[model samples]
Target: MTSTQRTSFPRQGVRETAIAVKTRFQSASDVLSDCLEEIARCEDKIHAFNLVLDNQARQRASEIDDLIARGIDPGPLAGVPVALKDNICTREIATTCSSKMLERWIPPYNATVVAKLQDAGAVIVGKTNMDEFAMGSSTENSAFGPTRNPCNLDYVPGGSSGGSAASVAAGFVCCALGSDTGGSIRQPASLCGVVGVKPTYGRVSRYGLIAFASSLDQIGPLCVNVGDAALICEVIGGYDPRDSTSIDEPFSGLLDSCDKGVDGIRVGVVTELLAPASPDVQAAFTKCTDKLAAIGAKVDEISIPELSYGLAAYYLIAPAEASSNLARYDGVRYGLRVAGQDVESMMRATRSAGFGPEVKRRIMLGTYALSSGYYDAYYGQAQRVRTLITKAFGRAYESFDVLLSPTSPTVAFGFGAKQDPLDMYNSDIATIASNLAGHPAMSVPFGLGANNLPVGVQVMAPTLGEAVMFQVGAQIEGLAQ
Candidate 1:
């Protein structure tokens, strides 16, 4: 389906829909019905949701309608339907991480973002699928099954947040929340053709996100457009005492920032990030830069060579952290546990049976990296490389307001096209640098690329620079329109 074709489903965006619902132009229930109807119509083909909370969502909508009748505003979201990636804990709802180990494990508490969404009057629709333990570039790593791209059912929606991106692209929801560790959010948003944000590491609370790599992991929004993404970010962002890494400052007025045009903004087109991109992707990027230049922004090509080591550094650091975080899933505590002749045997049996091949592979890689003999040569060196990348970004920011690149090296590929692990790992080459630097990054759908599939232009900002990042993203979005 072409970009024009998708307009039939979502019909309107977050702000418009919220206003209509709030002003009695439409009831919250009516908006939710449309969402559920759309999910029912295409979910079988798209497989965007792991669980659809129809009865629960309807109940919430009814409550919002009651609030409106009482002359009390629900909040900013005002009855907007939203989906949560399976990895984000939603009290009593299964947070599977698309892995069999946690298939039936219901989180006892809602994640910080989940609570924030509810407070904003957003109705929780359901949990979306992902790469098992958030480990693969394609949703194929999911133990449940692969989530096909809504744009082209034959193609893989980029992962490990593929289902969240697909849900928005398929019009299953107006917005969804996803976690980004490396390129999980942006790459999938690019491939699936939507807006995805990865806020600065601590800008949003991470209190209940199932850890993939604690240091690198961040919860963010995936939406149909930039305005909605910004609103959701503001709603879910802010300091949370529960999260030690949470930023102490306020994160409001982001929606307003979207309207601030990119005039005089210094936009850097990263030469290194663009080098590995496919010709179609590069062409689309060139057009994006040209559009920015036409709009009175200073667009110029710049090189950040230290970013070349991002993928290698990310592979080591993220896995080492994963090995530590995942160690808690032993047979004694929660999740699937198989009995054995002894404690040691039981632990081995449970892990071997519980984790998928990809998850196990990452676990092994992480364990080895952190091992006594290789710590300094591998994991320690990777940390040092991460510092270099961070410092390089700092210097680049001194001269550039924001950096630009293709969100993914190529558009969404067919399922099973990248069977080799290294090929799949390379999928995040253009996006990993932002995570390493703990910077803000987002993917804005610019236009279609090879095979007429959608392509995304990435906008990156320094730590706490989300406001300006959205400004650029909104401009790119407007150019596409």
Candidate 2:
């Protein structure tokens, strides 16, 4: 039997492969073949993808080879194999958010980012799993089942973007797209030992994304390293007329910005962010911060008191938006619908059968929060708190070029270790503040912590500050290595 373990695969990532493909050092077909083989070897064990489009990937590779045969450059991400989170639609593909409701639902068009990736010659392997409607922190909530961490099969690969991060760490794909509503991307990236980013709101178009929280959701990349993350970000990010939230910002040359170094940069270590983290994580965080100082960065502990309420605010705000956005799935149109005596009954039956426990829980919580007489007490207060968090982030950035903290409170935990929902919510405590603030934040793998599982240090920058954020990340990555 072929070994199911994924010990190693091609070290050359998105950047190296693009260079090799262009120079004839490696044909796109040959490179894709190697990637496919690795995916075959690992997917069964890791459960990284909701679907593996082997034939489609192979066909795309041939097309890229044809372009190279005619001496044409297929843009920056040439021939790179990428995995997209299932929530990000691809034309004619099942854009299920790992929910049974849309299990057979296919999208008529690709998301703006998907189109961008295809245009740049990226070979999309398949759609990775995600939480139902982008809710939940662990992949466990997926109606399709959980994505096991490649680092420890018994543990979850942090979630709702668990499969996206797992695919990169397991070598199933070089990069993957995932949306962050809270710490969906960064927390999972930390657990799975990869670079995961939540770009500033509006930085990446959400036209193709199935919404969970319109105000908080932002699509970003999970990659093997900081430079790969930067490359993927530049490719999929830009202004899009289709998405009302798409900002008119030039996203050129993010890779060039990565090497700017951290010398003389100011980094504020948020004290409150660290207080919730486990001791093992705190130690790893200190080492990473030390590396920044050694490289001439000015590091200091800063307090953002308002940030303490961020997770509470996010739980209210995100679910409220989710309840509203998800209302479209009321069995009146597309997705799974069960027959009933009348339309209302059919709709109620379909939703009851379609949604998982976590999703239903949030919908109820959100509906209650948005209901009359309770809005101000819950959802309204949450929005006010969100504003304070945003201002708090701004206040920190005033004295610092970037803020730093442990991406998660602990390393990947065993399935069911966090049985209580409250316990699971703490997993994202360190990373949620930025999402609530609509600022860009990323999780950079620093080193191993408990059980030798990876620990990631989060670097959050001001709005439109991804360039400098990546620059510091590249530096931290160098030290960790």
Candidate 3:
């Protein structure tokens, strides 16, 4: 394993870096070189990157510099180096998803978000590591190896977007794109002490994201702060014709509304979240609410009874979808294939050999749930629970502008602390509800806890209320500073 215990890298700002490049205050080439230099310094210790497209990054930077010399505006994210979670397609770039199944497979097209980022002038730095096909909470399930926390190398970075969060926290890049299914993005961002956002289902196009659970999967941004997150959200969010599930609404004024504090905003503290969080995490959350209250926000406790059933439903529903989605990865189409007597035998051999243990476990669980005899008892019932969860959120939103909770029950834990699947499942307890309800939620770094690891305070909004979420998140960030 690489030595991940180095001192935390000073984070870079997405907006500031873009501004610097746009104004010629710093050349794009110089900025990218600095990023590469920083990556070189910590890449060994962090192992955050799965593939570093150094030459491509340099060439892109040079092109941006030339555009600037001609007095032409590139885009909002101009010249900013951004990391992408490996599951996202990147044209010919390798997007392994940190799994051996796709280790040798390269996509022929860019994911919608990748195209948007490139169109907006953000330089694609490289593809960061991730949990295999966005499975597992710790990222330890990755076939390539685990991504360690930058805060303390002994600990694991939260995942499956661990490397994306680690890259930002390690200062390898200003911002990175991560797809959230359950707590994939927020949990890791909380552990890494950065901003992580999961837009409402359909708020961002999921056309190119390799599906973990089609209903729960939403791609969002992990960045240094709320401002950066809001900026990226605005840039990538909107309707996409290719995505049938996409909402036609555009995410307007995110950057403008993002800095607004929670003054007079009605923030609800989820009643159930208190029990699952550690005392230290509870203390951090209390302090954050107190700070918001002191700043004139009205904070109150609200009950979302259905939230208690979230985890149980999520495991069943997500896996059921995952089993269906993963069915396409059989030996016939692409990725890894092991020799066998014939087609059926070959498909069986490939999947058995290619999928990691965690993935296989889920596949089996999902397949069993979707089986004729158990479908209604498991999968059907789980969807009903999801509807109830969504209704609970809707009721809460009637009285509260945004909801708050600890992003995770505790902070970044040691690698082997939660080996059992049940133990690992606890990590996403605070985040699964929002995914179930298809609501926008974010994890904002609140402060350091007694363990010295970062504690994140989650802010959730109603289906298209990202503006409200970011505004409240900004207030939480203010408390931390």
Candidate 4:
């Protein structure tokens, strides 16, 4: 496709073809072609996708066309092309998790969310890049190379869902799936000027998604707007028997509540969380709060003292779990494995060569924290802190329907500035608390910052309260316009 043919869609949202497909005016193949053409035009600059599933997407789109021809309903998202984070498994596509360790590994089964989207007639365009093993806040840590922000190429795309965020922002896909562990989904969504939702932990099944910090990781959608995110979440969110961590509750009314404005809703502005944010971010967040107030919702600045330690506690707990979960990639089973003279040597060789710097750092930290001599001092203390943070959110939720804050302290930063692992991990400071509290949180574009990059206001609700979140998010989305 020529540049003119590829750049046909407006930069603000999903392509016209994709919108037509969703509205039932065109076949899935037509929408898929538009997205593919865009990807071909911009992938080199954005580095959004690690692998583009052109053949499979085309074949799936054809199947949807056949269904339409037969007078069979393909569902609301029929013909829409969406991208998946590399960590989410697909039947034949390589789910690398943005690590060389699994560069060529193809999952035999699909993640519950991926299967759900496919069943809804959405085409899986490809798997996008991510931080290695979802270990970093900037996509710069991807084994495949960093995914640059579409808004500003010099800056990092908030990760580990940076690829998904960038792709959606650049209009390469209608929507994308991203897994949030810490601020992976929300932060990237913030930076890329998209809507990213991190559902209450366990609300979305984790059956085929590569585990990062199991308790903290939840898969969600990155889309052009709140409505699209709600639609995608409704299709993916539900109980899954295969996932022990999946909740057995009825589906949260996220989609049903999107049209319900946040009138009379109590939105709490977490004072502690906002205090540390940059001036620009704070200003934008305050503006969003004021907008909410004007809309007839009660807004209050609430204090949550325990939130101060959220980042420290998350680092400990996440890595401890990561160390245990990543043990399966020792090269003896699936993924890249270099043969050594003996088992131990082979394992050491494979890990040392396959894993990236950030991955190794976290693995080492996790192993050390979980070790017998240091477990109590590090992992145990972190768990205690986690409990305190959860309690803090619970206490706040008692008086507020939802908690609001800046998703990240600032907008996207220069790629190389966060090379230090410790500095990079701090990027998730504001978002980790929600994950620790097991609450649903969303990042919606609030305003542009001093750098002209987007700033996102995070709306978080109590566990299993996604309906409340969607209601609030929809109101914010409107105000943002």
For candidate 1, lDDT tens digit of each residue in 1-481?
5432333234467788799989999999999999999888788778888899999999999999999999999999998989999999989888899988998899999999999999999999999999998899889999999998888887899999999999888888889899999989999999998999999999989998999999989999999999999989999999999999998988988888989999999999999999999999999989999989999999998999999999999999988999899998888989989899999889888899999998998999999999999999999999999999999999999999999999999999999999898899999998999999899999999989998888999999999999999999999999998
Evaluate all candidate structures by whole-model CA lDDT and list the values in order: 0.92, 0.89, 0.91, 0.87
* Clashing pairs for predicted structure model 4, backbone only: 28-79
**Tens-digit per-residue lDDT, 1-481, candidate 4:** 4231223232333344445665568768877787788888788888999999999899999998888778787876788888999999999778999999999898999889988998888888989999999988888889888998888777788899999998898888889999998989999999988899999999899989999999999999999888788888888989999899898887746677989998899999988889878899899999999989999999999988898888888988898899999999899779999989999999999999999988888889999999999999999999999899888788888899989999988988887997567787878888999888888999999998857889999999999988999999999999999
Better of 2 and 4 by TM-score: 2
Clashing pairs in 1: none
Give the runs in model 4 whose Cα sits over 4 Å from its true position: 1-19, 22-24
Worst 10 residues of 2 by lDDT: 1-10
Distance from true location, Cα of 81 in model 2, Å: 0.4
Off by over 4 Å in 3: 1-5
Q: Model 1 Cα displacement at 473 (Å)?
A: 0.9
- lDDT: which candidate is best? 1
**Poorest lDDT segment (10 consecutive residues) of candidate 3:** 1-10
Better of 3 and 4 by lDDT: 3
Q: What are the TM-scores, per candidate, against the unseen true structure?
A: 0.98, 0.98, 0.98, 0.96
Least lDDT summed over 10 consecutive residues: which range in candidate 4? 2-11
